[model samples]
Target: MNDLPAFLLRKADEYNAPSFIPADPICVPHSFSKKQDIEIAGFFAAIFAWGNRTTIIGKTKELMALMGNSPHNFILHHKEKERERLLGFKHRTFTATDLLWFVQVLQQHYQRYDSLETAFFPTPVKAQEHAVKHGLIRLQQTFFSTPGAPMRTRKHLSSPERNSGCKRLNMFLRWMVRHDNSGVDFGLWKNIAPADLIMPIDLHVARVAKRFGLMERKLPDWQAAEELTAYFRTIDPEDPVRFDFALFGLGVLEKF
Candidate 1:
């Protein structure tokens, strides 16, 4: 695995795994010892999570100000010393749903730590309202929430599209964990094993995994995720997602 180019591998891993930055506002610590600090950091992360670290280059300030003015949107203590780096919209890319989804999270957090002081929060259950509001979450007819709901997948499916979804979701999760983009303080919730996790099947990851013989099914879809995950389960049932890096690395480094 290390045979792949270091920088390329790093980029692949950067996109594949969670690198929780400290400045991210959504990275709720497992222990709420310093809750406010963690939540603020988590916020910073989710904001930049849309694509990559480079994607959300400098959008912290705008979000911070939005938090300040939108009382219902954000909660921060007046007395707390804020990070100056988080002062302005260094480079903002706005989507109404993104802001709305963020506030919904705050509404839940406030139920406990009434003040805007930083507090650790775990990944809250994804609400349908937020999905519909921001129109980000995917809606597939076959994607029901029932236990082991079946989704459609033809055998001919290939990479890029099939595995791309996981890329997006994983990127989002990374944003959910860090305070900044640097992984300086790994969040408390970093041990999450992505069992029964949905595959964000984009063409890139799927084609790559298939080329490495990790996936037998040519079609990349929900069934593909399940089939591939079953094989990985045997390798390390406790945390099968580890294969994602190896598989993704194959594609990024063009090893396959």
Candidate 2:
């Protein structure tokens, strides 16, 4: 409070964070095999991915199909029944091949298991690390998911390809974590904290954040997210990500 910028300090009073907004995307077939499967299906949807919306839309739909929803049922029919249907190969469309690859790997790695939380994280390092250790990278065409490695946060994007991957994961996390109705709640990440989370910064929001004096560092990378998240931490240490909507909307809406 003592050193915060005048503008950011105001958001504490300006925004009313939604109590919840459909963390439907994070549920995986493993942890999601039981309850709230719609959320898991939604978690698979590519909603809120960072990139051109056009590209993301198709990918989202494809992911939906892979999650066992009917490819023809654009209305998300399975959203109600929460059935365990799989997309027959002949009916496939709209999904990213990479995502399908990951899903397949998930099926391979956790075939006997369930629960993205127990099957994935709460370890010493982030989930990406365990993915690598389990040879998920071998599952990849090139870059493998490695344990104890840097994550694909907003700042870590090195190239357009990496940037795309970052968007995919971010979109996935958004649907899975914060979003509510999209699927079943794995509840794996529930006890985990936001300070433990990283910001998914994009150029537009980075620029806006800077203009608003939210962050001033020139080079956008892991450091920038750290700094920005740190400042937000000042507002709500337990859930700095709660400010994500306000910050992202500030940029997207071009609000000064």
Candidate 3:
């Protein structure tokens, strides 16, 4: 276990580079320079990141193109009549209905707040240890706060309350909150510290973590995600989730 930190650091440094962006869903947000555009694009990319990487990137870019490649402007000012262009959009189970609802909620949110980071905070009080967990719960609440939100869309947004791993949302938060000169993760948001961010666990991450003895949970639920992250914190308390690049690279790229 003593060698684990050096190993992870090497893999993280290897994968957390500009070259890693083009072939991954992170490329969607990398396409934009503006903060709002990155947040909006990154959110969609993360939400659509379940299947093949190629398909995920392709669908994200398609959606961006449909929005005239200015997602922030299109989300805030585009008329209802103009939304007809989005009517036929579909990425797996994320149908046009779900997409429209997302747009509506985002439009409402950006109207009052300049950044999507505000949605995660929800309240003024500081939550030190469980910030990401609480933030995700609040985000889901705000996401479905609007009347006529589709029941089906709930599956798209996972939360710790439901014992979900919340892989997508956590990944989105990592992109916005984790600071580094890697030129990969955006690190645009400052309210949530990098230490508070939870590890974004998927099957690949779970398998790798368990093999490393960093995790012991059989099921990749919210508890397992938290457990894995706890172990990672021991290795690098301030930037534990940075190991995500290492685990992901090992599992998906190196096939470790």
Model number with the top lDDT: 3
Local accuracy of candidate 3 as per-residue lDDT tens digits, 1-256: 7698799888888998989999999999998999999999999999999989999999999999999999999999999898999999999999999999999999999999999999997444344878888899989999997788899999999989999999999999899988888889998898878888889999999889888888888888999989888888888888888989999999998898
Q: How accurate is candidate 3 locally (lDDT)?
A: 0.91
Query: For residues 64-100, what per-residue lDDT tens digits would candidate 2 score against the true structure?
Result: 5565553223222334233323333221332233333
Q: Flag regions of model 2 displaced more than 4 Å.
A: 1-43, 46-48, 54-58, 70-97, 123-188
| Residue-level error in angstroms, candidate 2, position 37 | 3.9
Q: Which whole-number lDDT from 0 to 100 does residue 156 have in model 1?
A: 14
Scored against the true structure, residue 84 in model 2 reaches a CA lDDT of 26
Model 1, 1-256: lDDT tens digits are: 4333344335444644344322232333322244453445344444354444444434543454455633433443332243232343333444443343334345545755543322322233342222211222221211233344322321111222344233444433333333334343333343232343333344666887676566777766555765665666665554445455556555544555
Off by over 4 Å in 1: 1-53, 57-94, 112-167, 170-187, 190-201, 216-220, 253-256
Model 3: lDDT of residue 179 = 83
Better model by lDDT, 2 or 3?
3
What C-alpha lDDT, on a 0 to 100 scale, does residue 23 get in candidate 1? 27
- Score candidate 2 by lDDT: 0.43
TM-score for candidate 2:
0.56
Q: What is the C-alpha RMSD of each candidate to the true structure, in Å?
A: 11.1, 8.7, 1.3
